[model samples]
Target: MSAPRRPVLAGNWKMNHGPSDTARFFADFLNRLAPADDRSVVFFPPAISFAAAREALQGRPDVRLGVQNVHWEASGAFTGELSVAMAKDAGAELVLVGHSERRHVFGETSDETAKKVRAVLDGGLVPVLCVGETLDERNAGRAEAVVAEQLAPVLSIIRPDEVAELVVAYEPVWAIGTGVTATPGDAASMHHAVRERLAQAFGREAADAVPVLYGGSVKPDNAAELMSQPGVDGVLVGGASLDPGGFAAICGAAG
Candidate 1:
């Protein structure tokens, strides 16, 4: 039998929570769920709440801390940007790159995403690299193509040994924040394709070791089904993640 991929149920609390909110969420979540011992339930709070998160989540080794975004540069005059060094200093152990919001809203290109991925890995932090297809592309039967294109640059930059540390979130653009979810079968198919691509690039052993998560409108109602699908290692939750109880419930499904 192959080694199991530890499920990662990540809460991407984007621009929604303050420091107080972060503290409150954990306090409630820890009370509701005892946290699965075998999975990674990461909290990707906005940068402003990292300090509060670190404080609130202390002593809970079962919970991992992450940040929504990070700059590739270590330190410079990149105004309004938080570098990996800054994130590390602020107690972030994982960082997200290529999130759809960073791609579409902030105009972060694949090359820039690649830079961030490399920085995070080199800095000893894990990188959750998001990749996906737009509605039009999926309708055109270019879903796989789009995912490949988006991931190509980052894969090219990362070393083979670092492959296992990467988490690829297959988020369909149309489904994100739109209350629509890619059916479990559909998400599994995409995840299979992603694994095939990784195998081609880094060989099967390394590929199988990497966790490919499904994102985009994942909720408690559907989290179990999605995570149960073959090749779907976990979930990268958005809106539903804001609710501590809801997110904890999703984490429960992952195990």
Candidate 2:
């Protein structure tokens, strides 16, 4: 039988924390995060703070680092954007693709996101592809449809063999950073839908092995319950992750 899916606790700093703050955050985070062999933990700090986060993560190789975003092109006048190679050089082992802000705030299209996913994979980095629906979409009963649409382009490009390294995060736009969260039941249902979509793209065995995380206002109080739900392989934390102690508490809960 295939091995069980490993839990992944990832933090998306999202324009918050600089080099100094990153160093201090890791200093405290590492202390509170107990060593574990059953799960994986990753941090996607702002690009500017990559070095500081890397330096701080010296002894803990188990804790991986990632870029919040990447450009599809290897090099160009895409001014103000970092290429996949640059991100890899910056010590990123993974890359976040199609984050809510990038989709809504920055007008990123699924086609573009597809290219970024391909780029990240080609550059030998893992891609944490974030897919979710907006508040209106959910209210209109189109949440699952919206998420499937977003996943289509990216999923079509991923080979069955790559499913194990691909991390899909379901972060409903309405709940993110809005002090709102989906109930465990609601989150689990969505996660189940995501897995079904994965199964359609890759086979059941490969899909079941993919880590599907929930990431809408996830906090310490509700983390364990969310992680305990079937099909919720892990979480992608936002605001709550900014706090060293709080994030550590959430990580501990994942175990």
lDDT score for candidate 1 against the true structure = 0.90
Task: Let me know the TM-score candidate 2 reaches against the reference structure.
Answer: 0.97
lDDT against the true structure, each candidate: 0.90, 0.92
Every model's TM-score: 0.97, 0.97
Report how far residue 207 has shifted in candidate 2, in Å: 0.4
Off by over 4 Å in 1: 1-3
Candidate 1 on 4-122: residue-level lDDT in tens?
A: 78898898989988998888888998898784678888989988888998999888888888888988988899888898887887888899899999999999999999999999999
What shift in Å separates residue 59 of candidate 1 from its native position after superposition? 1.3
lDDT tens per residue, model 2, 184-240: 998999999999998888878898888899999999999999999998988999999
Candidate 1 has a TM-score of 0.97
What's the alpha carbon RMSD for model 1?
1.5
Clashes of 1: 0
